[model samples]
Target: MKKPIKDQKMVIFILLSNVFTAFLGIGLIVPVMPSFKDVMELSGSTMGYLVAVYAVSQLIISPFAGRWVDRFGRKKMIILGLLVFSLSELIFGLGTHVSILYLSRILGGISAAFIMPAVTAYVADITTKEDRPKAMGYVSAAISTGFIIGPGIGGFIADYGIRMPFFFAAIISFLAAISSSLILKESLSHEEREQLSSNTTNFFKDLKKSIQPIYLIAFIMVFVLAFGLSAYETVFSLFSDEKFGFTPKDIASIVTISSIVAVIIQILLFGKLIDKLGEKRMIQLCLIIASVLAFVSTVITGFIAVLIVTCFIFLAFDLLRPALTTFLSKTAGNQQGFVAGMNSTYTSLGNFFGPALGGILFDFNIHYPYLFAGIVLIIGLGLTILWKEKSNEVSL
Candidate 1:
């Protein structure tokens, strides 16, 4: 029996809601974190470590989470992750000590490792190969939309207190959790489940098999892209603060504008581009464009120029994410959760390394982080070209 396309659409809608909720919770922290630094008397290195610890936990846990999702079920894992995320947000909102905040971030990372990859695998399960990129684009758009609203609201609340943003984030996440619990259905068919249950392959063996060269290349591309982007986030607000003497409110407005640009590109341009040009080509194009924009951002003097370049960076970054993920999903065969988990693991690696790199660069100079990111992006572009050529040869 054929699954109805309408049912698939409903699943995508629920997944999008999930993505939006999760990111809104994270985005609310971005603008507020710098303020926390001031209030808590935390150093730049301390801030970097605090953020990187989350990624470290995610990197360690993602492979296991992915296997569990494949073994258990996507709907179950997503619900569990959402519950964990909401609880973490609640803790984060209520905590006064930096140690508590650190614990919250670590817990949140564990939740994210489960939620993000499972969501991607679920999309792959429901979507046809032809329409996967379009589905992924919607996911990306949902994230950007959350980012657009989250920071704006967070910045407003930050004027009252840094903790207030976390409260709002927790509420949003809890609501999303309820929605998912009600609406999301299992994508795995009974026959497929039975086969998996009967065969009883070891999870680690399956994980190892999923880490093929193509998958590894895809993971590297994602890692590099994420690293560059995360480094930018670690330093961008500080740069604005130091270079332009911008307040938290002004930084929030700038990020809000970037988020709006990202949302537009993800929704309006990415799907068409991915369908027409193919995912590999789109990835290459985005990398080149982002690299150029990152370099330009460093050289530009005025706040307005920086803002314009930043818009381009956001556009490229946002478009690349879905394109890359779609490509990986298509290539991963039956190991969708494993592949997605590997992707998450790479992203976690980026998140961990990028901030530390950015902190070092920031200590030397404000522009160094962007400069380093551009260099890394250029390297990624080279790898992307090689990967594309190799992929074509394999397909032929």
Candidate 2:
């Protein structure tokens, strides 16, 4: 057998690098989506369709994704996922037809199904329970960094051509794949792999047993949070173009600033804060604050005020993500890959519906989606309030 990892930081750094590249690909297209609609002569609903299709594919594959991560090794799966992601971006860049775009999105979704569960489970495997939150924070910070930086670059390069960002995405993802193959060690032990190979049928039964009430609530919360957040993200460019009279670069700038704030909160604030406040309270607080601010954002049209509110919203978002991830990991027990995959499934459900509805609502009234999202977040706040967790319970 290959030797166990001697340097944990090196392994983690490699994982974070791959995460940054993966999310960068996703964020690269966000700024240029409006341009696609104009050039393709597509309606808002069609735009939403394109966004939702990716998540829909994720939804279909996520149940199996977890098993695959455990069954195959994390290193192999991560590298394969990156390869597929780069190919998908290449397809998106080269294709001119709408159907080809759909195909690209499907491929991207499949790539995500492989990437996220494996990455999260890999984190869980390497870190101690006490250290998990901070490690996850580092991971989240990497993703947020990619998101912020991608748009800043994408918006500018997109001036050359809308497809330029896709080519950039392809190049970056390919590099990420090469890095993973060369540098990252597999997280799963050989004993675990042998056990998995012996119990194909029992894996399903174990998965069924792993779904507990707290986990169910955690799943629901992840879905609702992603749903509400997606409404804002999916239509932000269109809404700003119409209401704020902002160009793509302007929209990109605002998002870049918001994203930078998020990165700080995730890396510097999220772990220590979650350790002190506890996951349940953090979720409730972020939901209510984010909800109120999202509503206030609709009424305050001034760019500076909106940006101020956006900072708070981004902070809320950053805080909630790690909190929920820590909470879900606690509930997952030994089935980290399955639980992470389930988490991705719920998130995919939200992503699928959020954009479709947000787009339709945006066409009816630009302000409606934001208002409705705030209302939906309130429902999540209520759910968190009702949840019960035992004192002194540790995930292990």
Candidate 3:
């Protein structure tokens, strides 16, 4: 029993590490973006398009990725995703043209579409219902920690060369893929995969069927929250650099510090807070907090003030994510892969529109993204009134 429990722990660690490396690759590019923009002679809208394209690819792939996770099995998809992530980073590091960077982003989105739902469903497979919130917290923390470290390291590494961090990210991701391929165990059985495949429909059909009375509102909230958050984040470094004359290192430091604080809070208090507040209540509160703070961000001036606000803003976004995941997972019985996939789908949709629109707005006014994000969150809060959780009766 002890050995089995220890093995489960090890598997969880490897799974979490995969998530960390994937996100780390994402963060690695952030601090270098301003430099990348200048070197490529790109405009603000082009920068936004670069970010939005990743989500666009993700939105397109998530439905198929979800069904594949259910049909194929988690371990295979996860390994494939890690490999794709490595390749995307390598391509981005090597690319000289803007078109190549866009291509890399498209591949990156495919990797995310594969990894996120698969890992999420993998975690659900391994953990018991009572233990899931804590496990989910660890999963969320790994993501935050990766984002925290990626920019900090990217900032310092940019001193070597702007492209160096992407190469580093590529190497680490490749190593992670190899490690997972050798050691990670498959969580789902053959019988389980067949069961899921028999029940699962194609992407469009599944999406159409998902709009029943039960979890529809929860899905909408996911989209709304993701849209608002992406709008704020997709333009963050650009926002800092343009508004306050912040350099890559300065932007990196602010993001790293803010994310560290959010990760610390997640590690220390996430499960306890969820138990006390419930997922729905916690999400609502975070939405309120984030919406207000997004507005405050536009008016604030000093670096210190911005850092303080950024920490709280990150804290809210970080908390809201797992809270919503927890809410959705509670009722999603055998359809963990399906549910996680839809979660990714809606998130990708919001991610797609948020940056696409936010980039245009950012060009018009540096503060417009934040203002727009705040408005989106306010609308999400209003929609939360419709979110009443129930047993998963409708199959996708």
Q: How many angstroms is residue 376 displaced in model 2 relative to the true structure, after the best TM-score fit?
A: 0.8
TM-score of 3: 0.90
Residue 269, model 2, lDDT = 74
> What value does the lDDT take at residue 190 in candidate 1?
68
lDDT, candidate 1, 1-396, per-residue tens = 224346566667779888777656545666676777777876666666666777888778876776677778888888888888888888988887889888888887787777876787788778776676567656656755764456666877877777877776777777877888888877797677566556544546644654456666788888997788778776777677777876768777777788787776676776688779888889889999988887787767776787788778877888888888778767766555456556666777888898778867777888888889999999988887567423421210
Task: Write candidate 2's Cα lDDT for 68-103 as tens digits.
Answer: 877887888888889998999999999888999989
RMSD of each: 3.4, 3.2, 2.7
Model 3 misplaced stretches (Cα beyond 4 Å): 1-5, 70-73, 124-133, 144-149, 186-196, 389-396
Backbone clashes under 3 angstroms, per model: 0, 0, 0
Query: Which candidate number would show the highest lDDT if scored against the true structure?
Result: 3
The TM-scores of all predictions, comma-separated, are: 0.85, 0.88, 0.90
| Segments of candidate 1 deviating more than 4 angstroms | 5-11, 70-72, 124-133, 140-153, 186-213, 271-281, 333-337, 390-396
Residue-level lDDT for 305 in candidate 3: 94
Worst 10 residues of 3 by lDDT: 1-10
Candidate 2 collision pairs = none
Better of 1 and 3 by TM-score: 3
